[model samples]
Target: MKNIIILCFVCLVTISDTNSSSDGKEKCEGIYVRDKFHKKVVIGMGLNRPYQLAYDHHNHKIFFSYNIGKDDEDSFQIGFLEKGHIKHKVLKEVENGFAIAINNNDNVVYFGGSDGIYKQHLKSNDSVIEKILSHQNIWDMFFKHHLYFIAYPSQKLYKYEHRQNKTIPEHQKIIHEKIFQFAIDGDEDKFFTNETGLYRIKNSTDHRIFYEGPKVYRAIEIDNKGVPHFSGQNGIFVVNKKNDTLEKIAHVKNIFGLAFDNDNNIVYSDPHEIVKLLPEDC
Candidate 1:
């Protein structure tokens, strides 16, 4: 009877493994979403759960942050893919977080680390990485009229005046909730996301909730037409201004970060791949 029971248990384990394998195959090996204006292309592979994505328009490259190893043994590093190149290049291994910002006007790239933010000139012959902001840990950042970052620990938003090397006073209290990421529209309207949902603040006016959802991803961007799009485990979604409704554009799985390239194409990252959404005709 003991031997018979052992054989039954083994058979059950085999059946479970087969079902899990079939389910995974069904989830990953099919077309999940469709769009007329866009076709997806896989540009990166074999990555370790890449998180944030930033495009350098001046250099025509896409930079991404990911871990060098699995949990506990993992270290953060920034990698980039040059236009028309299949090879991935290591930009730098940061000591801390995975936030990256590019100042195309200044030809510089800024990355967040344990100390603060560090800058590297993209065009300069000198390949030195210099620390620009220290003491304050950064979660995520972006550059528009100025440098803006979500501070670590507090999770509040702050703007830095690089020219004067000081934090903007009025921007210190823009919102009450914790911020994860943000984007400024063409009209200078700011959109932020956190645990609660997406928020918008315009012209120093009161913050308005645009979408109420849980745990939106850190990736968000405004297209050239000023439409804001963000991603999460569900898929990529866009905010419809006509009636303030959320629309899912791509049904891709586990999208984590997004950025718009110079030609207005959308580039996004998932667990181990970077893909671009391009016009179908091309």
Candidate 2:
């Protein structure tokens, strides 16, 4: 049972603390993330059950999903982080939160849930959320060239283009089975992962199996040069666009969320703590 609990945590669903302190803050474990020097530091705490993360390097902000239910509470939440402060709002309408994407044109973050996709103006005084699209369960989303490519677990995919100068979205449809996470390359190429392999979508007509193996992998995190990295059963692995080969970065497992800054510094969270795989000390 103990191992099962840890596996469930690694598989993405998480449990939360149910108490608040006299300071009017939620009583949970302190937030700890390893810095670029591979040094661990306690940053902040009181998050319910922090899950998938999206980093906005252009704005120096982070967005994540968490459980908001605690001690008679009954909601899930999405959190925004900026300048060491976090503000979370309850997502009462979203049933299951899965993915997040940041749009460079507007600098707004879009969140995917079981029911629909939603967005809000970041750091706005009036926090009104706008629904982008409705689906049964949105698994992941990616933004490229003023458009969003959304993944559905029901073996379908859709493209939403921001029209009228990013105000209205025109939706288009496509079907690709088992596709999960995707990232756009500098050449407008798509590098996506699936249930059993890594694939590539290029030239608007080619869907080719780039790599397939016995091991199950998580979503793809691409760097500035279009290199993809992931953390899964074999720890963190990298797929370089130049060679398209799998390279293992670390042996640690149970990585929940992973992000890469421009310098190729890696920050990821396990079930217990966040860690950074800094570039080799040169």
Candidate 3:
């Protein structure tokens, strides 16, 4: 059944590539944020190569990956900052890593690279660096029901069941040639992605398109009111699931990462600097 699905997906990819004109030429505008009162609190410095971002809800901290140099072969480092603090602490460094996901415990983090999947125990400073599956370049990772779901840009999905000590193919229902970004809601029953526009996957077989846009890099499902917040080359978009409306909240030209805190604050990082979106002064 899975092989059949992969074959069908390959056919679709060929068709889409032939029909489409270079993945849409529209570039995102308004890439910076200035307060209504003209206060520029956040700034983008442009880093070497930044990738995934994760929020530690329990400790109110945000984590992100940063490359050391311009070369794609440069080493990458994982760092985190407190909710209201601007300083960051480098947690770990690696040769090549991306698509990182921090466990709910805020102590365990999972990431993938050209090699395979790995886990880091933050508290003990010990890591379980093992290759779960070979030849899979992971683009994103998230936890659902204690199981780790990894998305590979090459249209492959993997689930690592901790209890079973095994990795298996999952998300057989999604049929996209390439998936740029995806976000798993806390409940694990629903997820949003930008494979063929923003889509909500209710189950392995049930799903719906929330909205359509250019290729997206990252996304998060906001619990404040269930808004589907996403970032791409253009800017940031907030999808109102209740009314099915998409609003362009802030325009950041190069959005590398995004996360939301328990207090409903939004945090994002470009290349060099990280910024937070705070509510208007009350």
**What lDDT does each candidate get?**
0.74, 0.59, 0.59
Q: Write the per-residue lDDT of candidate 2 for residues 98-164, one digit (tens) a residue.
A: 6777764576777888778887666563677788777546767776665455555454456666456
lDDT by residue for model 1 over 158-180, one digit each (tens)? 88774465544235576767888
Q: What digit string (tens of lDDT, one per residue) describes model 3 on residues 1-282?
A: 999999999999876666443455322222333222112245334455455777766666666777865575656766666655666666544335666777655567666665566776655434455455556666667664453455554644556643476555465345444555555654343555644566666545465646655545465544444455677765777655667556677777677777666766666777667766654432
Number of residue pairs clashing in candidate 3, backbone atoms closer than 3 angstroms, sequence gap of 3 or more or interchain:
8
Candidate 3 global TM-score: 0.67
Q: What is the lDDT of residue 110 in candidate 3?
A: 69
TM-score of each: 0.79, 0.67, 0.67
